[model samples]
Target: MPELIILLLFMVAAGIVAVEIKDLLASVIALGAVGFTVAIGFIVLQAPDLAIVQIVIEILAVVFFVAVILKTTHVDSTIGRPYKGADIFTFIIFGVFALAFLYVGVRFLLINSSAGFEIAQHYIKHGLTETGAVNRVAAVILDYRALDTLGEATVLFTAVIGVLAVLRLEGRKK
Candidate 1:
């Protein structure tokens, strides 16, 4: 329990440092570290599926973003990008928002979500008869939530297309 708290604090600190850091490359590295920290926390919280997804997505996103930034880096860059007080205020406001979300999330973690547990139990008991599938999650996704799964599949297909577009050559077979 104490270890998880320390890890969570570390993750939050890393994320703040990442966002506030001036160098884009350093920010990406810190963000990747923070992602690993949160992924570990997710594993500890018993959602391995979500943890795996988070880790994969975080690694892919940070790598792609960093690559794009590096590719666009030029020594002859324009200067005099003025930073106003409003910019500082904007960051402060976002930090407060993050803190609020963290507080509510921790409260939810500590509380016994009986309703959710009960719902899972109910599904486990009743869904077997409704669907021939043994796995409740698969049954729910494929049978009870056909439309939702279809939407998610569509989104995944769109993401694949976007990635292909990003990596496209000049109509060359390579």
Candidate 2:
């Protein structure tokens, strides 16, 4: 809805900032902003599992980006630059957005917990019989949620490939 459109716009802006920023560290921060925004979008879309995975992956990506930038870049652009009002403004904006997301996520959880529990109960009660699996966990994972599990696996594999590609590029430069 409107919230999704706003999130998409903010994500695009962050992406542009990441591309246009002169400072490497700042650019990486902007990139992280884009990733975090996407995670929020996932949460808003009622996909908490995807949001959790995206948040974890985004954290790892940001860490890797910062480490690589620090190691490879010789010049430090931020050394003599004084803190600006824009910095404080950006921090405040992010804080507000974080609070909003937290509120929405909590509200969603409160509203959906009962429904989620019922689904879980159903799975537990019938999973083994319906799936012909030995255990409830196996039946749920391998039969009931197989597509979701496969999608998550694919995402992880793609992230690993991306990291490997970056490392390979760094090696080629050496």
Candidate 3:
């Protein structure tokens, strides 16, 4: 329990630092740290497979963030943007939501098992047969949740394209 709290604190601190830091590289590193901390949390939860996947995804994401930062002229676009009262208001609203979410999450995590345990068992037992996939994870992600996977891929592609466009515009200005 102590370890979980420590890891959760580390993750939360990393997330806050990632968002609050001005340097793009530092923010990216903090974000990576957040992901690493989350992977540790997964390990603590006895989910080694998820931990491995999280670590791999975190590494790839960090690399992509670094590449985008290096390709762009400026490290941050908000360097010159003036802060407004709306920003503070947004932060206050975000804080309220974060607190509420944290409370609900803690309450849920304290449960010995979730309500979806039976559903998960059913999926584990029948996923491959139903989806015609050899692996349960593959069946779940590629067949049952194919649209979600596609949407995630599309979002990633869009982010890359947007970064490229911004960099191109920055280069043209020079």
Candidate 4:
């Protein structure tokens, strides 16, 4: 439980730092830290498959983000300024929304988790018979949830293409 709490804290802190930091490189690093923390949390929840996927996806995302940042010109410094009234008001509104979201998410997660286990159990029992795959995970991903997997692959490919385009633009600019 303590480990979970620490992981949650790291996730939240990393998210806030990533958003608040002025430096692009530092923000990218913080985003990576957030991803690492989330992967660790998945591992802690006894989901090694999910942890592996999360880690791989996170690494790819971080690499893409860094590549894009590098392809652009960097601003040497940000001018210091006081927060505007609108900025403060927007922050407060978002803070309220965030708190409400957290409350609802926690409540939703705590309700009837056993139903989720039922689906997993059903898959484990019938996966091989239904899909004829030796490995249950493979059967699920390749057969049962093939479309979802395909969508994920598509998204990854799109991101890579975007990164390549940015790099190409940088080359052209040079």
Candidate 5:
């Protein structure tokens, strides 16, 4: 769709800005923008659950990045100079990560091909009756996948606690 294409373009531009910007804080903010854009794209694709998770993770990641940047020394003498070794190291690390992610994604799809469909069918057929809910979506979210929902809530809570801990200033007098 056109919206997805626009979102993809925005994400790419923000990613480039994040990587190329001289200001660390601005670069982090641009990276956060890319994450938020991905979340928006997830929503537009009708994956609200993924969108919610992405938004929460993006917020936590951005907060942590900002906190770390604030606490560390920002002076980089090698900004203008290109380090071939560092560049190659970074590229290799990123490539390995990307390959691992792709492998996991492919394995997940392959493993869940039929099982996922069966689970969906079960939920659709038995959701209201099993959960005694008026809405199918409510039944699926609140009853059928209650543990998954709880886990998501726990992750969000943990992320919030982490942000609070990172933001806490030590040795402040009352």
Candidate 6:
């Protein structure tokens, strides 16, 4: 229970930080932190494979984003801005939204869990018979779900190409 609470808190903090931070570098780091935190939660819940996948993909995304940030910009931001009433009001609104989302998320998670576990369990029992893969999740991704994986790869490729194109433009300008 305490572990779940900590995870929830991290999620909320990540959300707030991602939204509230003005620095691109800080926001990218926070995004990576959130992803790794979720991966840890997944591991604690007995999904090592899922945890690994999340960590890998998140790390990849962070690499891509950070690489782009490095190639495009470099600067430290000032933190000396005077606080305003609007900042406080916005933070309060964001806080309320986060709390509401947390409540709904926890409730739905508790309610909808068994149905999810049922599908996983079904795969565990009959996966070998149907797909001939020892790792059920791998079977889903590599065999039965190759289409989704292919789409994801294509997206990643496009992102990489986009990054390269932007960097190329920068080089040409110089």
Clashing pairs in 5: none
Q: Residues 39-86, candidate 5, lDDT per residue (tens digit)?
A: 999899987777887999899899988888889955545577766998
In model 2, how many backbone clashes occur? Answer: 0
Clashes of 3: 0
Local lDDT at 130 for model 2: 83
lDDT of 3 by residue, 20-61 (tens): 777989999999999999999999998777899999999999
List lDDT for all candidates, in order: 0.83, 0.85, 0.86, 0.85, 0.86, 0.86
On residues 1-174, what C-alpha lDDT tens digit does candidate 4 reach at each position? 999999998889989988777788888899999998888898999878889989998998899788878988444265356779998999999999999999998788679677777887888998878988867778888988999999989998998899678657445455
Tell me the lDDT of candidate 1.
Answer: 0.83
User: TM-score, each model?
Assistant: 0.67, 0.50, 0.63, 0.71, 0.63, 0.63
User: In model 6, where is the ten-residue run with the lowest total lDDT?
Assistant: 73-82
Off by over 4 Å in 6: 21-24, 71-121, 170-174
lDDT of 1 by residue, 1-174 (tens): 997999999998998877677677777888899988889999898877668889999889898878888897623233346778998999999999999999998789668677558877877898889888887767778988889999999999999999899889778678
Global CA lDDT computed for model 4: 0.85
TM-score between candidate 3 and the true structure: 0.63
**lDDT of candidate 2 over 112-151, digit per residue (tens):** 9998789889887787778877666567767888998899
Look at candidate 5 and tell me the lDDT of residue 95: 100
lDDT of 2 at 25: 87
What's the true lDDT of residue 62 in model 4? 91
lDDT tens digits by residue: candidate 6, 1-174 = 799789979988997887568787888898888999999999889878999989999998999889979988634454447789998999999999999999999999899999879978878898899889998879888987899999999998998899788767445455
RMSD of each: 5.0, 11.5, 5.1, 4.0, 4.6, 4.9
Off by over 4 Å in 3: 19-24, 68-85, 97-114, 131-135, 160-174
Total clashing pairs in model 1? 0
Model 3: residue 84 alpha-carbon error in angstroms: 5.0
